[model samples]
Target: MTTNEFIQKLDGLFAAQEYGKVESFMLSALEEAKEKEDYGLYLSVGNEMIGYYRSISRFQKAYQISEDMLLLMEELQMDQSAEFATVLLNTATAYSFDENFEMALRFYRRAEQIYHLLVSPDDYLFAGLYNNMSSLMEKMDRNEEALDLLMKALAILKNYPDRQMEAATNFTNLGLLYLKTGDCNSGKKCVMQAIGMFEALDTPASHYSAALSALGEICYHEKDYEQAVIWYERTLEEIKKHYGFNLAYAVVCENLANVCREMERQGQAQEWLKRASEVRKRLEGENSGELHDIDNTAAVVNKEEKTVKTGGTKQKALERCREYYERYGKPILKQFPGLQGHFAAGLVGEGSECFGYDDSISADHDYFPRFYIWLDDEAYEKYGEELRAAYQKLPRHFEEFADTVMTPEAVSRCGVWKTTDFYHRLLGRQTPPETMYDWVSLQETRLATVTNGEVFEDCGGGFMAQREVYLSYFPEDVRRKKLAARLRKMAQMGQYQYARCMMRGEYVAAQMALAEFIQNTGSACFLLAGQYMPYFKWMHRKMKELSALSEVAGKLEKLALLPSQQDKWDEEKPERYRFALNTADEKVALIEEIAGRIAVELRRQGLAEGKDSYLEPYAAEVESRIEDPVLRMANLV
Candidate 1:
């Protein structure tokens, strides 16, 4: 076939989604190029194959093709040529996606050098290089560097005003980076600018939809629920107008639902939730992959943004862990060939990181891209050490990450481990606990940690499936019993004792009572939702995720920050003390009001029944509803 006809045929097959035919045609063209000794044609065909392989997740083949391009260039004695630089850049990209940052960076710098020395600037290549490098730096927890690189990319696009779509993308990246750094104002500004640019230009719906969705995220985090709704609505408008029902549309729909739920507007939330389901059906029809999860509540960063590198939240850590598995661990196991099905891979432990609660501050000691490979008995005895060696030899620096500091219990983490031993260490028994007593007695926080985080694969050994069952939570009676006790404590501290302490002029004791009340209410909310209370660090943060009484969380936070009477007592005499006392009294009333709201939720759930405003009566009513004979007969406290 003539070259033009061959190119047209290849394009037709690609447009028709006939991947098999496209691959077949490309292979024949590649063979012809090699036989004709046309290095440029050979490289062109190889690059197309590389893109095809990457689109299909055949990353190993993608990297291999890039390697062959370099080999052909070297054989032709073409060093320091623009063509060689293109191959080098392509190879660097393949390595970057594989999370081998050291090699990727080396090649990227080399390619950049050649581009500067031997080639005129290609606007597309210049903008893309900086963009991809910024992404890599972001994954390394080097936010400042990532931001700098993105700005550089934006600078490049600015020179080419027709590249408005590319500029919008750069703006979106900047917005997300600013948000990652806790600069919500700057994040919102950049994202809004991107939205404006995308709207002005004839860009794809995704460009503008992403920008609007990011604004929604910023407003949601700032607790500007009305503004969040507006931003999310704009995103929904864009998606429906252009893309119709797709994953992004579903995501914005669900994001709107979450904001409405948080604002105590359940009817609106429900409407949006149904829209989300419909969008999911459309997304599924396109085989776009599994449905994305619910956007994480403020207690965690948005799961949709997990790939953005900033702090080390447990969610981010899990995402990083998955990236590592797919890039390094999975490929290594594939080399084992015959033994692939004899193992499982995931993160399992009682650590805060395991619970997806680790942040950048907590990550200072031990937290990053790490996971366990659990092998079967036979696999453990034979190939365990070899697999461990392979893992050790895998790329140590992924993205911008530095060498990991192995902790004291090094062998138990981020390496080849036996599944039985892993479970025994985390849960005190092999596999998951099978009895009610085992579930009840074990610390719920530990259980949450053990069952949280992603299991990339179980290699058909049933490990992932059983973990799913363990995550379904304890028996209904146990949840009610726990909720009842927490409710009783909240009533005693907030509804009963706080006001009494204030009345007696025991100012310090009153503050302590307020603190305890907030704690009880926070824990009670988690129990009410049948969720395990996370560690104390995440208790108040996670409390806001409970749609039952999440509005109370804001009040609880204000109560925690209330000034003790002494601050005013020392500054002035009677008047200041009176002012402090009045503030304390109002806080106590607010706490009680929130307690009543919790009582309302309990009654709605049929877990409590009473007309009494005092929380103690409602607590008693809830205890009476516990169905388990043993738990129901147990003491209220």
Candidate 2:
């Protein structure tokens, strides 16, 4: 086919979602490019397919394609080009997703090398590279180095104008760092500034949503449930209005339910709780015994009458877990005789019913006869295949269970593994080394917590030592970039346009700002999720498990429910809309406060020096430049 027709055909295939056809066509194109010695076309075709492979979870093929691209770049001696940088970044990210952090880091550094050569010192692109590097450092446990890099990105942004959001992001991250090190005041200031900027700029829903969510977390930690509930509510509204029944919203709602439950808002709390439960049921679809209700509440009983009955024991659950382990455990041990890792033989930690408290309700789900296999790095080196084979041989169907849920293969394979070895397989090392800056970003997220689950061994303490590594957190620079992007957009929408349009009765214009707000906030949440060790899709899945905050999922759904102008725009709809908006605003305020605290915390932790100014240095700088501090501070500029 002629080139244009071929291109048209390829586009058609892509539009049809015919992935295999797309791959085949692309491969043919690659071959043709090679024959023509058209290096640029070869690279382009190869790069596109590389992304396709990665998208389909074909990591090995993706890795192979990346290698081919790298070789082609080297042949052309364009290793320092943006094209090369792009490939490198793509390759590193792909590897990182596959848990091959070492190769990912190496390529990421190379991408940075090229990126630095082209971008200005203070540019967002440079900040992005620094951010990625800092994340890698956190994964590696080089906290000090990560901190230094984050500061460098912050310093660069400080000197650059029109970098309000970026600076705010840096401030927020700095706040996270402080929180990590137990420096609450500084962290609060930084996070507050970030929230302010996002609100002012009319950021996407998730940006404000994340900020508010963090604020709720801070409040929870401070034992301030009222404030936490308010922020959580706001976060819930934003996520509901934007993401539309997505997992992130569900999780946030679940979290909000927790805040409500803690604050004695049982009526409101139950609403959220019910939503969370429904979402989980939907997500579980066909029930899997491995599904754990991490934040689920127990059956309610009269507080004064049956406190003992209401408060379930962990021991009962343990017995069930042990029973399953015994039934299936022996066979796994026999299959992998070469195992010598930390948890080579049996179950421990969460599934270790012998060492656990029994909670009968826990057996409703996630409780099963399963155990994790532990191994040291050396045993994996010698007997990885045997271990894999043995683990895969375990029965998929378990008979004689109250809930005959299918056990996920991932968890079933768990009994034959060690925590450190697993991490090494997935994260390129046993642990991730995050900088103080990374910690700042991470404190706003759950990636670290998820990755930190159920460590099965500490043989020689090597695995435990690496716990400091792979501490899935965001880098300061990336946070800054995203924050800056939000600020710039928010300014174009919320502060500058929304109220004026509303006053003018220009509902469409007002709605546009709302749209802008939704987009920015949604992206922000994704950004927060991205910094951690979990894959993006998985993060969304886990978020939905939070049954308490499912209202956010409602809000996300509502965003797409646009009203027609021919009919007087539903006045009732606006009230419902305002509910979401008000909630989002509250969330924004909470997040901003959290960001401020983050700043204070970081400074106290010594990751950053005191700026001797207001809540945020960058905000103060902008405020100082504004002709009217009141108008500027009020977000009227």
Number of the predicted model whose TM-score against the real structure is largest = 1
Q: Give per-candidate clash totals.
A: 1, 104
| lDDT (tens digit, per residue) of candidate 2 on 1-637 | 3456556786677445454467778889989988998777777777777666654445657756766676566557776798888787777766664555555675777777777789777777777556556655655656777678778888777667676666666665566566656767776776787788777763342345666676777777788887877787677666545433345556766887787677676665666655565454444453343224322322331122222222131234434445555677655655555443333333433222323332454455555555555556676566666766765676644543346344464363355455575554544444554443333333222343334344433333244544444433344343444443444454445444554455456878777876675454343334333433233223333333221121233344344464433223324255454433322333233323333333332232112334331233433333344343333344332
Q: Quick one: RMSD of model 2?
A: 26.3
- Reference-based TM-score, model 1: 0.48
Please give the lDDT score for candidate 1. 0.68
Indicate the residue-level lDDT of 228 in model 1: 94
Error of 2 at 501 (Å): 77
**lDDT (Cα atoms) of all candidates against the true structure:** 0.68, 0.53
